[model samples]
Every structure is written in C-alpha cells, then in structure tokens.
Target: MPFSTLGLSEPLLKALADLKYSEPTAIQKKAIPVILSGKNLVAAAQTGTGKTASFVLPMLEKLNTERKLRGKRIRALVLTPTRELAVQVEQSIRDYGQYLNLSSMAMYGGTDIEPQRQKLIWGVDIVVATPGRLLDMAHQRALHFDELEVLVLDEADRMLDMGFIEDINKIIERLPLERQNLLFSATISDDVRALSKRTFSNATEISIGNNNASKPKIDQWLITVDKGNKSALLSHLIIEHQWQQALIFIETKHGAAKLVSQLEKRGISAESIHGGRTQAMREQVLNDFKAGKIKFLVATGIASRGLDIGELTRVVNYDLPDQVDDYIHRIGRTGRAGASGEAVSFVAKDNFRNLCAIESRLGHVIKRKEFEGFPVKKVVPLSILNYVPKNKR
Candidate 1:
C-alpha cells in the first residue's frame, strides 16, 4: 500500500517521495500505525525487509513537534547491536525526516569519546546508539534519559546474542518508566521474549514471516569443491556470470583478507571489512560497496547484520556460516524488498554438517551446481536428516 495511507505526516511523506519510496513494505504496513498510536510494540522482522523504515518513519512522525531539550536530554533513543547498524538507522532517520526540524545522530564506540561528548552538549532530538557506547555517555553525564519519550531496541535478538543484555538492561533502567517501548527482532527467541515481557506492557505484537521456511525471492544453490580450490571456483563463477556486484561472506578476518587478495590476483577488484579494521575504514568500505565503487566485498560475519546495501542482486558464501541463522542472514544481504536475487555457496566436504543444518532450516535441499574444472575430489554425500544408528536407536 502507498505510504500516504499509513498516517504519516506530509513532511515525512514528502521526504519518502523524494527518496522514491512509494510503497510500504509488510513490516511498515503493520508497525507504523501502532507506533503512530504511541502504543508499545514488539515486531519480528528480518533484515532487508525494509524494517528500518518501519520504525524510522513513525518515529519521525511522533517526534515531529519541537520540544525544548535540557543540556543533555534526548526525546527518542534507538539502540542497535552493531556500529554499522547504528549508523545506518540514524541515516534512515535523517533521510525520512529531511523536511522536519528534528535533529539526530549515530553514537557508537571505536572513535574518540570527546567528539561524541561535544555533540551531546546540545542534545539531539533523536539518538541511535550501541548499548555500550550509550551507557558510557550516560555514565559520563553526557546523556540524560529522564525526559526520553520513546525507547526502541532495534535488533534485540542480535544484541542478546552478542551478550549485551546487561548493558541493555542498565540503559533501560535509567529511562523513564512511563515512556513508550518498541522492540524489533529478526527472530523472537526465548531471550527476546523475556526481554519484551520484562520491559514492555501489553505490547502489540507483530510477526511477519519470522518462522518462514525460506524467502522465495532468493534462489539458493551450492557448488561442491575441495577447500583448496574454493577460491578458484568463486572466481570462475564470478567471471562466468559477469556479476557486477556481490557481497561475499567468509568465516574470519584473515580469511576475508586472503579472499580479497585472491580475487585481486584474478583481476577482480574487491575489498574486505571485519573486526580487525578500524571503524573509519569499515565505514568507508561500506560506503564504497553501497555506492558501487567496490563491486566485490569480502566480509566476515560482522558485515552480516548491519551493513545495509540496497538492491544487491547477488551474494557468495565463500565459507558457510556455522549457525543456520547466520546462513539466512548472510544470504539476506541480497533479495531485499522482494527483489529477485541469487545466493551461491562454495561447500567443501568438511562443511557437510553446516550444509545440512542450513538446508534443514530452509526445509529443502539447495540446488547443486557443478562448475567446469572444479570437480569435487571428495563428493559431499546427500543430506539425510534424522538418521540414527542402529545401536543408538
């Protein structure tokens, strides 16, 4: 449905129109009105489903009116799991609130605290931050949530997975108990449920395909090859497909770096982003990838959740992620917003267990493709789940 029917104000609608966001995604359709009504909400939405806009649009609409802030008080706060996500969500706020008078900032660590402190001198209307950095600001008396009107925990599941529950609780404790609360997650695990129950009061729950088997827009497939020849197979597939841009997921920082070098050696320009790189470098790399300056980006799991790349047509799993959930997120980088996309994986024999888990999660086997000159020396046996040995049985 058109965004105009979603109760968004004219200014927000104008901003969305400027960005050519004509239609609202499923999450936006469900979550926006509830947020506009100032009710507590718990939404289960996956990445790449335009979930960012679901919250940002309504938030800007809610904070549309001006309120004088004290020295270091914020009207709304959004807590994200990663620095990348923090930056991206803040950017979305800015983009959607362009015509409004509200001000916002993305607060995160890995940089000088003094600059962040200085920005807090005159509090922003909205602040998107990571839990640890936000707590640091609060401790140093650079931020005050006493008058905060809205509190949003974006990607709550990921935050819990990264062991940020304590920090999250600490931050939540400092906020006004009467404020509106909103929690959005890709998966509503037991931990996420507990957090919601602890903090939220009769929240309106919205779940859109949280437990679905698969995304039909994404065509997932795999190629079996030896570990040693996986890189060569990736190069072959890229050259054969003539793919202009694709996010390649690897297992480690070192592996990401090695894959970039290997791709460069094959005359394909590429870049890498991981924990080892400085925050500035990671941000710049993300910008380049999004801007199409870098056609191939080799990233570890750090890039899985928060690096928002739009209309990405393809992704390559240089190494399958250990968790089936991660496999879904890695491929989620593509096929966003109902766009047709491709996900290819280089699977070695040793990765059989991971493959089985991923396929089991999808409720089907991934289509297998054999590349010329990339014959499998050790064929991966077909996945046979629920098999118990005679003795065990």
Candidate 2:
C-alpha cells in the first residue's frame, strides 16, 4: 500500500517521494495505521524490514495534525539500545520529516553531554536516546516528559537484554499516564511480552513474519576449518572472490582489530568498530564503509543490533557467534529490503557447538564447502551427529 493511504501529511508524502520510497513495507502497512489511530501497539518484524520508518512516519503525521503540546518538554520520545541505533533513528526522523517544522535530536553516551543539555533547554519536538543517557538527562532535569504524547521502544528485546528494564520503567514513570505507547522488536519472547504488559494498556499486537525466522533472501553457507586457519581462509576467499564490500563479524573488539590487521596484510583495506572506539571514529568508519571507501568493516556484536548499509550483499563470520539469535542478526546485515545476499561463516572445531545450536534453531543444515588447501580434518559431529547430514559425513 502507498504511504499516502496511511493518512500521512502531504509534507511527509513528499519527503517519502524524495527518499524514493514507492511502497510501504509490510510492517509499515500494519503499523502506520495503528499508530495513526492513537492506540498502543506491540509490533514484531525482522531486521531491514523498514521498522524505523514504520513509527517515524506516523509520529510525524501526528505532530503535524495535533496542536502543539504544553511546555518546553519532549513531546515524542524514542528509546533505542545503543548509540549507533540512536543516531540511525534520528537520521531517519530528519530525512522523513524534513519538510515539516518538527525538531529532533539524538542523545547518547560517548559524546559531550553539555551540548545535549543546551539542546534540551532550547527545546525539541522529539528525542531519540539510549535508556541510560536519557535517564541521566532526566535525573539532571535536562529532559522532561510531562508533555510527552507518544513513547516508542525500538528494538525492545535488545533494550531489555542490555539491562535497560529499570531505566525504561523509570522513564515511563515520568511520562503522562494518557499517551500512545509502542513496542517494536525482531522477536517477542516471554520477557518482552511481560514488559509490554507493564508498558502498554490494552495494546494491539502485530507481527509480520515467523517470530524466529531468518530472512529467506539470505544464502547461508559455512566452511569448516581449524582455529589456526580461519584468518587465512577468510583472506583467501575475499581475494579469490574479488569481494569489494563485505561486513565481517568477530567475537571481540580485539579480534576485530586483529582481523583488520590480517586483512591489511593481504592487501585489503579494512576498518574495525567496537564499543571502545570514540563515537566520531565509529561514525567515520561506518560512513567510509557505506561510501565504498573501505571494502571491509570488521565489527563486534555491537554492529549486529541496528547497523544498516545500502546494497550490503555479503556478510562474513570470521568468528561464529555463541548465540543463535545473534548469528541471525549478524547475517541479517546483508539481504536487506528484499535484496539477495550471501552469508559465509568460518566454522572451526571450537565453534562446533555454536554451529549445531544455530542449525538446530534454524531447523535446517547449512551447506558446508571445503576448499582444496583448507580441508575439514576433524569431523566433530553434533553429539556424534545432528546438524550434519548423513550423506555429507
């Protein structure tokens, strides 16, 4: 369905056209109407499904139609899990609401707080922030939600997992009792359901796909190699396949840094991003990678949450993630917006358990390919066989 039919303002529709968005995504089709109805909602959809635009569009429409709320307080608040996500959401708001008079800012850690304090004092119509930093602003009286008409939790599951439950509760306590509350997550677990019960009042629930399903457009494959040969295998594949741009995932910040060094030695330019890097460094690296200035971006689990790149066709797992859901999120960096992509993993003996857990959770065995020099020496079966097919063994 077209966004115009969703009751958005002419300005928003114009902005959408400028952004080259011709149709509303599934989540947007279901969510925009619900949000425009001024009711509480709980939404579930996988990554890269236009979840950001779903809420941003409706919220902007509401702001355009409704009379300005009282005070210099925040009227719309969006809580995200990480600094990167906070920045991403704010950018979307700006892009979608450019024609409107709405004002929005992103507040998160790893940046100077004084400027944020000044912006809040000057006033803003919307604020997208991480839970902890928002709470800090609240405690300092730099932000107030007494006039808030809408509250949104993007990636609710990730916020809860990151131990933001208490912060969220505190923030909610300060919001006006009568307001629209929306919770959006990739997966709805028991804990997320319980949180929704506390946060929303008789909210409508909408889900776009199978709760734990991976994107069907992503082609997943794995290569079994020894721990010592993972770096070599990754370098060989990138060089041989002439991979110009790929998002690589590692288990730790140090591992990401090390992988960048190894790839550099192979005459491939790469950059690393992690929690330890300054916000400026992370943004620069991400921008460069997006611009094709850097072909490879090695990141820790920090990138799995809300990183989005245009035409990101390849994701390589130099180190398999321990959590099956994390594995899904990692590869989800590619195959976004209905585009076909490839997810390649380097599975060592130590990652056998992780591989089994992932395949079992996925309910299908990932096809394994062995290269000439990198032979699969040790066939560590899943408890002597589970994810590995009998024919392959």
Candidate number with greatest lDDT:
1
Model 2 lDDT tens row, 146-222? 77889999988767645466678898888999899999988787768989998777999999987665333889998
Model 1 / residue 175 / CA error / Å: 6.5
lDDT of 2 at 239: 89
Q: Model 1: which residue pairs collide?
A: none
Task: Give lDDT: candidate 1, residue 282.
Answer: 87
For model 1, the local distance difference test gives 0.84
RMSD in Å for all candidates: 7.1, 6.7
lDDT of each: 0.84, 0.84
